[model samples]
Target: MLTVDNLVKSYGGAGRGRRGGGPSEPEPDTRAVAPDGSRVFAVGGVSFTVEDGELFTLLGPSGCGKTTTLRSVAGLERPDGGTIALSERVLFDSARGINIPANRRELGMVFQSYAIWPHMTVAKNVSFPLDILPSSRRPPRDEIDRRVRRMLEVTELGAYTDRSATKLSGGQQQRLALARALVIQPEVMLLDEPLSNLDAKLRESMRFELKRLQTELGLTAIYVTHDQSEALVMSSRIAVMNEGRVEQIGTPDEIYGRPATRFVAEFIGTSNFVRGTVASVRGDTVAVDTPDGRLVCSGAGAAPAVGAEVLLSIRPEAVSLARDPHPGAVNQWAGEVLNRAFMGDAVDHVVRVGAQEIRIRSHPTESVEPGTRVHLSADPARVTLVPA
Candidate 1:
């Protein structure tokens, strides 16, 4: 339902030197860098489309421009260059000098901080947006009350409808904010880290609720967050951004299982990078020589030339640890346990294999202690090769 093309934003003067040599000063056409040696295009050259009723997410680390892009789409910030369209309506076109004001865009937004007025009650907060509605489009007072009451019920805040927003808990306030956004019956919802303020447990619960609400309402949503797990759980597709550019876009499974780049692989999960030299290529498998031993891995996308240096990305859970060695395995490494950490249902083992430290995950029942000899084997298909 929404599209952004060739979007770029930058801050600071290019070729200028900072007190310390940080990211090169923003170029004449580039966005300025933050004080932390990080540049902000916030949403640099990002392009993607969200299908009607689809929940799309922009995910990355802080300063990756996910939030900047969302704000730009909401007309909160002007873009350096780009076009934004919502369901064929031109919301922004830098070249055409077309920029629709935020209120006229027919979109709802939820902020990281609950932007509810402390003096307002839940019903009043939800009714605030409707005041801007054209007279013909505005609902009657009784109808507005009914809509607000129903929304509060949907968000499970019916009992608090008359209570002042300031008295509500964080989660409650968030629900109130969501009710207010949905009360407008917006075609699309722009959520900017709306759940970031909640505790871990509440955050997890709210994700499911948020997804359910979107599906029930069939609302197109552009969710921005730095949390990979949150994106994975709620989005129909994730547009992974880095340094203002969209690095990759795909379903959660695709982004996690077969990341397009090393950055995506490393950022999405606990991945182990194994430095090795390509030993040989046979059929679909590529063999590599590492400090520990020869390892065979399925070529993810590109197969490095024989003898070329490469890095293998493997998830921690993919490495299996055994006290007894397997007779015939494509990838095997013998290592001494360096340390072990118990994390609820799983045991994390740091194994020293030659000059490399490999992490392995096993069930809590497994018994391999520090100083013990252990063998690690991984499925060839689970190993992804990337240019070193």
Candidate 2:
């Protein structure tokens, strides 16, 4: 298990002046400075706990501090505050003045670039970490060779064991990097956008392979990425970050279906935002008035008060469009198809309803041409009402 408590880091300090400033010392918290001279918090007070053998992911947009948090855990960057612990061992504690060296932390890391040594063969690259072991504790030469071969075979790189890392393709290099990391047998693996370098198809395949390896080895893994689909497909739980803070943390389904905040609802997936004022609240549902019409939505956490301004977040897949209206639906809107886009297995339609535009997704087989009048309806329980 890994636990992080109130981690914080700032770059510039009194010794480093602003770009055009004179010899005078810069502000104490210059790293946090904004264009207007206000302090910018790269990482605010962030805390989370990951279970043993859990595949936890930190997901967010670029500059959301996901990478900063990962570096802090790896000990490459010292946080100005907070504590980090792995399996009850205190690796970092600002108050206690304890900061373990990165090499002594016993954690493996794989980067987006793979970071393989071009000068070394696959076997040498995987065996390099073992060189740090004390002479008295180091394994025999044959044992080391056997273990390296096993790791290479597990990662499907045995055939290239003697090949220089630079000769491998992007995907092969990525697998080699993983093999090298696993060779050390660390308790936790930190992956920093490891699949970002691969093509779309390869990225998808690697996600499954990485998940399978993590499960098979019962290794605790912390993956960091800005790609929402990657996070959704691989992580047991995702911590969504924004502006140096964790916005929400939950399983993929929970985060997608029941986002805790407006930021999360918009960040995790495509959502049609309908601005309106709450007309009424009934049980878990809330009635809101939009430019198109009144809509009954399933409020995420709590029902908004009547007349309060809110936004209805409706997923494209949750909406259904028909040439004729459906009976008994709590909400329906008549619209003209503005545009249609064909996705491989699905079709997306942009419908213009009065002054608002709503997106709907359907099977590719179901065709709705532009200029056609359509009736759009959704399950009331699928409409999510969030604060505007």
Candidate 3:
């Protein structure tokens, strides 16, 4: 397992910085070191663990510090404080004064740019890392050749072994990059937006391809991306980051189905957010009063007491429109369809109820016309209450 404890990396004012820190490396405890000047923290204190053969992902928007955290683990950016370890080996320990350089970390990295060498053929590009190792550490020539060939075959680049790196298509080039990285047989792989360069369709295709490759090789990897869909599709578990901090970490389904925070609910996928005040708490269910009506939600993580303010989050797909709801449904509101769209696989409808506009998605065959009166009902099980 790979573990990170309280990792922190910051910049600006009152410190010698990553590489230039004097005798005693400074801890990243100064929140406002700049005083009058501005301080920027690319990565605030964050921690997580990657289990054996698991594909872990750091997911967030631009400037959220996801990439910074990944770089810290890769040893490309020295952290101000924290301990990073792979199994029993300590890669870095702030108190111990141990900081492994990037090259010595024995990690394979694929950046947004594949960085393929145009001059070298696919096979040569993959073999380059092993070929350049110091004589003492380098494998025999025949062994190096075997490793390169094996990687090329595993990455499905064997047919293009002698082909110039520049001659391949976007997808092929991506595979070539992976082949090169895998050739070194690093213990862990760090991928930073490795598929962002491809077009949308291609990017989606590569997500599956990468997931397959990671699973087949039983490789432990840390993937970083801003695309929520990509993270949901590829990662075994995801860490959602915002403003240099991790908001939540869980499997893709858990994060989407039960968001721990409002930001997570809003970030993971589209949902209709209804602000309400808790009216009652019965067992695991919570009833919140809104302008539209009283909403009773089950499966809400914690049952808040009556009169507490909260936000009701219900996914569009969980809500449905009907001419009339079954009698005495827990959540049912009368509304008029304001807009409708037929989205090949599903139909989307925006319904206006009292002062709230609720969006509902259902099967493509079930759509109501605009301005038509309708009823919106959501399963109590599907409604989640977020602390307001």
Candidate 4:
């Protein structure tokens, strides 16, 4: 397993910058350095683990520190403080004064740009890493050739072995990059938005392709991306980052269905939020009084104390719309359809109830007309109670 504990990387101001700090320097305990200036923490106390053969993802928007954390692990960027280890081997430790060189870390990296050598053949591109190794560490020519061929075959690029790297298409080039990285047989792989450069359709397809390769090879990888669907589709578990901190870490289903915070719910996907105060707590069930009405939530993680202010998150797909009210429904509200939008396979309707507007998604053919009266009902189990 790969472990990172209390990793911190900052820049500007302070005693010494990220790379300037040494074992002799006294590190500041907090982000603030002096009365005259402060530091920008690209990664502030971020921690997570990547199990063997698992595709762990660092997901967030730009400048959220996801990439910095990945780079810290890759040894491309040095951290201010923390311990990074792979199994029993310590790659970096601020206290121990151990910082492994990037190349010596034995980790494969695929960046946003494939960085294929246009002048080299596909096979040469994969074999270049081995060919440049010091004579003491370099494998024999026959072994190098075998490894390169094996990687090409595994990446489905054996037929293009002798072809120039520039001759391949976008997807082929991506596979070539993977083949090159896999040829080294590194201890772990670090992918930093490798699919972001591809077009939408290609990017979607590559997610599955990368996941399949990682599974088949039993590769332990840390993938960084801002795309929610890509993380949900390809990761075994995801760590959601925001403002240089990890907000939550869980499986895709857990992150999507049971967001730990409002930012997670809003970032992961579309959600309708209702601000309210907890009215009652009954075991795992809770009642919240909102502007729209009283809502009951069930099967959530834990119940908050009564009278506490909270926010309720309900997914658009979790809500059901009807022309007539269904009697005995647990959480039902009568409203008028304010607008409707066709979203290809699904249609979204904005309904106004009193002073609140709720968005509900349904089948494209089930769209309701504008200004039509409708009823919105949601399963108590689908309504999530988030701490305000």
lDDT leader: 4
Better model by lDDT, 1 or 4?
4
- List the candidates ranked by lDDT, beginning with the highest: 4, 3, 2, 1
Over 4 Å off, model 1? 14-40, 282-284
TM-score of each: 0.90, 0.90, 0.94, 0.94
lDDT of 4 by residue, 1-388 (tens): 9998878888876543332222222333353344555677777677788999999999999988899999999999988888899999999998888999998999999989999998999999999999999999999999999999899988999999899999998999999999899999988999999998899999889899999999999999999999999999999999998877788899999999999889999999999999999998988999999887899999866688889999999999999999999899989999999999998999999999889889999999998999999998999989998879
Q: Each prediction's Cα lDDT score?
A: 0.84, 0.84, 0.86, 0.89
Candidate 1, residue 90: the lDDT equals 98
Error of 2 at 257 (Å): 1.8
lDDT of 2 by residue, 135-154 (tens): 88678888788889988988
Instruction: Judge candidate 2 against the unseen true structure and give its global Cα lDDT, from 0 to 1.
Output: 0.84
lDDT of 1: 0.84
Ranked by lDDT, the better of candidates 1 and 3 is 3
RMSD of 2: 5.6
Please give the distance, in angstroms, between residue 369's alpha carbon in candidate 2 and its true position after superposition: 1.7
Best-to-worst ranking by TM-score: 4, 3, 2, 1
RMSD of each: 4.4, 5.6, 4.3, 4.0
| TM-score of candidate 1 against the unseen true structure | 0.90
Q: Write candidate 1's Cα lDDT for 231-339 as tens digits.
A: 9999999988777677789999888876767889989988888888989887778999987788888855657689899888888899999987978987888889999
